[model samples]
Target: MQTVKPALPRPVVAVICDRISYFQHNVHAVPETYLRALHEAAGVMPVLIPACPELLDLSTLLATVDGVLLPGSPSNVAAERYKAEPLPKETLMDLHRDETVFSLLPSVTAQGIPLMAICRGFQEVNVFYGGTLHRAVHERADAIDHREGDHARAIEEWYEDSHLVSVTPGGLLATLSGTQAVRVNSLHHQGVDRLGKGLRIEAFALDGLIEAFTAPDAPGLVLGLQWHPEMSLGHSPLAQQLFTTFGDSCRRRQQSRLCTKSTGGNDEFISAYAV
Candidate 1:
């Protein structure tokens, strides 16, 4: 009898990159913060997906990965995505990234790929799902100042926990964090102004700003957080929980894919594995 070795492979996560001009040369980049957190905290391999508009088959690209992560960036989603007026010329923008991520959102949800978006990526998710954003969250009388502004403090201070967000009851966030409220870092100027379609409020700041949301209709986890959890992955229990949960989801997805391949697409055999 021939021996069949176990088919086990580490889960690989597709992390979207931002297009930027580094040293006067155009480049694709994602912050090291996200890479470190995904590898150390999430326990998964992180692969960068370039923000190239030439890639026409996003679904095909997504098929190779177990999960997708949209990391925070200095750029903001173009106002036109939400039918809002454009920001001043001074605002940082990455049109290539905007187009690539926006295109991938639908397939990620529909294909049952676990997704986690942070900060600017959170805003992108909202805009993609017919939600609008308050371009200046602090200027709103009813909202708190969520901006980590021009203080002469250290970079770490910019990502420090600034406020508490009330978690929605019975939501995935509450279950994951095991608490109704969690303190989070605030560094963005924009926030979700109108709730997106198919998304449930996961958490919000005291001032009623939408801090986090999840697509309940998604086959797998589709979560977005308006904070830099990656910045405190070592110290914050909530951050650790979030990444661990995401990592586990990716591993399960990887297992299921391997099972399908090993079973020659036999549903019964795949189900028996219960991956």
Candidate 2:
């Protein structure tokens, strides 16, 4: 008889898609990079949320998944969401994605879903909870110019480690990175000016700009990184740890959910996850 392989459980992670214009038509799409990394890097099954919030059942989606990934995007979140004036320079803005994500923030944080917010996603997390961001963070007097340079180059070149960010001691990041500092790619123009409620700093750049944070109050893992861990797959231990830690959390959540169901537990938490 042939030996059979055990089936690996894929922890489901909801990936928030962005609205984009393609082939002269507007549609919702998730970047391939995010999907690839979710599967290959994070060891999770990604379910794309392409439609507006009105179409999707949030509870149904949330109950099934172990985590949520808010990926970076070309367009920036509208400033009006956080009661700020628009950027002085012309910038691409996506109200559709902004609306969708902003609506989802409450349930994600409230339910304590594992969340990994990146780049533009970083800004969204801030705005979602009454936090503000510098319109042009690089120009801010106290912070370093964190933008990826003006020279046009291939995508791979842009993601290389550019500067070192000091991971806050005794925090999650410091533990994960196994050190006090880590190099990260700087490709964003907007950064946190004021943190959101229930959020705490995880890492900061050399010039004192917030690079990563965690929600200490939340039940599950809620990490927001200014740098792109998804892009730093094999080479960086910190990046790999970020995904592995998240993947492990999702796995535990999946196990807990299954155990709750298998044990005939009919409590509030069990009922919720059983979705």
Candidate 3:
């Protein structure tokens, strides 16, 4: 009998971001707080992909990455794109960031790349796939109190309570969480109105707001949650599981790349375990 050796893991992930500015102009700027949380969740290094003003091919960024963690941000998606009236108060929308992620989603999914969308990333993922948003969740008072605190406050202390989200039976979220209802911190004013094509709602809030969704037709790990899991990754087992799963997928993707390279760039000879 022959003994088998386990394969090695991949390198850093390319984390896509919008424009970022600091109050004090410094030579070197640090990673955003939420991004740091994502880095800790995945337990891997991060390669920041800044928002480019020029319309560049997203393939350039996707080629060097194994997985993508689409983090939340202060920016909101433009109402014009969704064909809705702008609210009296709306956050700035970064068109460059929107174009890059929108263009890469289908390609990334086709390549079986693992993706985790958080907050605005979640909303964008849906819109990219032909979904719609509520624009302002609180415009209707019957909806749940999705807004927890003032957005201008400190990021860590922004959330107040852990709201309950009922997970659908036989759903990916249910399998991962092993619970019918999970407590998640909320911090968004917009949510899914009409689900995107080929997507199934996985979880919802007490007031029936869409909390989580997944593409039933997606090849690899594709999950979008409206909450900020990265913020709670350190304290929540569920959040930790989410990151670990993503990291494990990335590791597998990296291993596959290495095996292909070792085989003279011919993937036909690669073993199934390479993936």
Candidate 4:
């Protein structure tokens, strides 16, 4: 008879929320899609973190979660973050979310916590590392019209694959997908104008816009994708893989924590199997 090993406890992941004004009151919220993906695809329990920098105790918060996820948001990062001129006043900027994410990122990267950033979160990671954005990606001569259509169209169509991105030949994304080219849904007006410090390009659209990146030197798994994989996790194999991989990293982190506590910080024992 074959023996089956016991399953490890599900890891807890912290997901940052956006600050929105709803019904004349400020609300901290994240879309249901990301929460579903975190549960169904990633196999993790998600705890939503409000975008309130004033009340949050970063160290205490990080100590409680195995990993952190920054989901896509409709709002854009303020241009001032990267030492650039502010865009037209019409652009929707979430200063609270920006402050929260920017404050959280340094500690996340420093502590080697697993991070998966998507869409606006992707741009947040870039800007956090001193990179700049195009502000208007479609206006660039070499870039495509990567923005999604207005609310007139059905919501499902907004997340359909918009173009193919060429994954870096030997990067993490290529290894995960087992292919150099992958179709992705694009839904943002701004894009990376300059590569971020300590970040390696993982994939790029055919029009030369950046689509994904990773910080290899970081002690933990750090991935940023400028697409809504959460929207297609039910049908896209790659999307499922992405979330699964992130969850696996979170599990490893959790196991390491438990092993350290049980063994009284025995480095060798924790390192032996955590990796």
Candidate 5:
């Protein structure tokens, strides 16, 4: 008999789309950096999950992908989702994304799919798990000013590492980054106010705001960051480490899927549907 080799399944990651308006036309968009990271750094196929309510079917989609990437966006998570009234000047909300991401989380947690949630995605994870957020971190009594000096400055200056985040020693975040402290850019005015269910702090900023978090109780890998690793990868070794760790998790999930499919074995963590 001729020798044969087994084929490995390609890992597929779902990257959520964003709702946008351009020239009076509605658009569903995904950032090029995020797509590039998933393809170039992570070496996985990224499927853009549409933000439209009418289109998203959470269970089916979650069952098909090895991981999920919740990328940052210009629109902010609406305050109303966490039972808070919106501020007068709150960034225009993307209710489409808000609802879609919330619906997707329960499935991701239950299915053991690795998740890399960044920036606004971090806040969404907080809210999805029953936590609340402060409207503006800079305005809070204890929170320091976490924004660049002027909005008119060049984009490079805006994304520069403006502050340091102290990682929890021996925690998941520290294990992933291999560092106790890391300097990260400050771009957000809002931050976590109350922690959500099953979520734990992984790192905190100098201003005492939560900068990164993970869900310990969840079956799969979950890493949430307040800063943008997608923007910092070139100069930040920690950024490269974070993405590499996440990519490994996704590959593991893909292998698990292949195993179950071949053997018809029961794996609650990798199961597509609940019994």
Candidate 6:
């Protein structure tokens, strides 16, 4: 009789949330649509993590999860935190969500966890690591028209083709996209100005706005893109590649976790058994 092999566990990616106000009640929430697309694109199950303003020790959550997915949200980070004036009109701000994620990022990166940051997540990752934002791109000195029309009104407008971005040579994004220029969906008004510590700019908009960044020194994957790959998954091979690469990294991390557990901290046992 043939010996049976045990099945491996599916990797879990934590999707961080932002504050949402509905019916006079405030709550931390993430869009179900984005979560669905992430699962479809990456083949990993997502766990929604509510926005918490208090500093969180990530070890508890990291022990059970393989990777992190920072989703986009309507709430903007308060300019006061970055020593800049507020936007003309103060957009909704979530102190708790911003504080929690900002506090947890260093520990997360230290553990060498794979992080996939989209839109606001991208901004958060940048700001958390000693970077600054443009606040409102249109208000800046040299800005391009970036806001895609309102969601309900722009469904038929093809917002995804609003901008073209160029990837930097020898960057991970350049290798992933297989070409310098790629058309991307744009719905953001804030962008990175000075890059974060240990990060390198990977791509930029045709108008010279920072579009993507990555931490080259990080042990695991640490990538941030200004556009929404979740929204463009159906039509963009590059979008698929982004999620697939992240999911593959998560799987490898999961396998390493299992190996460590099975070996009971015995390095020689893990090495021999892994081979």
Model 2, C-alpha of 239: deviation from truth (Å): 0.7
Best model per TM-score:
4
Global Cα lDDT for candidate 1:
0.88
- Ten-residue region with minimum lDDT total, candidate 2: 266-275
lDDT of 4: 0.90
Q: Mind giving the per-residue lDDT tens digits that candidate 3 earns over 1-275?
A: 97463544334676777765567532222247655765667766677765662545566665667888777766787666666787446466766777767667778888878788889889988887788888779887788767767667776677544589999999988888999998899888888888888878989998898888888788777889999777676577887888787888787777655575545544544553453
**Pairwise TM-score winner, candidates 1 and 4:** 4
The true-versus-predicted C-alpha distance at residue 246 of model 1, in Å, is 0.6
Candidate 5 off by > 4 Å? 1-9, 263-275
**In candidate 6, what are the lDDT values of residues 188-235, reduced to their tens digit?**
888888888888999999778999999999988999998888888778
lDDT of 2 by residue, 145-259 (tens): 7888865898788888999999899899988878988899989888899989878998899898889998888888888989988888869887888888888888887867665
In order, what lDDT does every prediction score?
0.88, 0.84, 0.75, 0.90, 0.84, 0.81
- Candidate 4's residue-wise lDDT over 203-246, tens digit each? 99999899999999999999999999999876788999999999
| Model 1 TM-score, 2 decimals | 0.91
Best by lDDT: 4
Query: Considering lDDT, which of the candidate structures 1 and 3 is the better prediction for this target?
Result: 1
Provide the global lDDT of candidate 3 against the true structure. Answer: 0.75
After TM-score superposition, the amount by which residue 9's alpha carbon in candidate 4 deviates from its true location, in angstroms, is 2.5
Total residue pair clashes for candidate 3: 0
Pick out the ten consecutive residues of candidate 5 with the lowest summed lDDT.
Answer: 266-275
Per-residue alpha-carbon lDDT of candidate 5 for residues 2-80, written as tens digits (9 for 90 to 100): 7344444458999999988889988889988898888777878888888986887666786689999998876788888
| Alpha-carbon RMSD, candidate 5 | 4.5
lDDT score, candidate 4, position 57: 93
lDDT of 1 by residue, 3-27 (tens): 5554555589999999999899889
Candidate 6 lDDT trough over 10 residues, lowest sum = 266-275
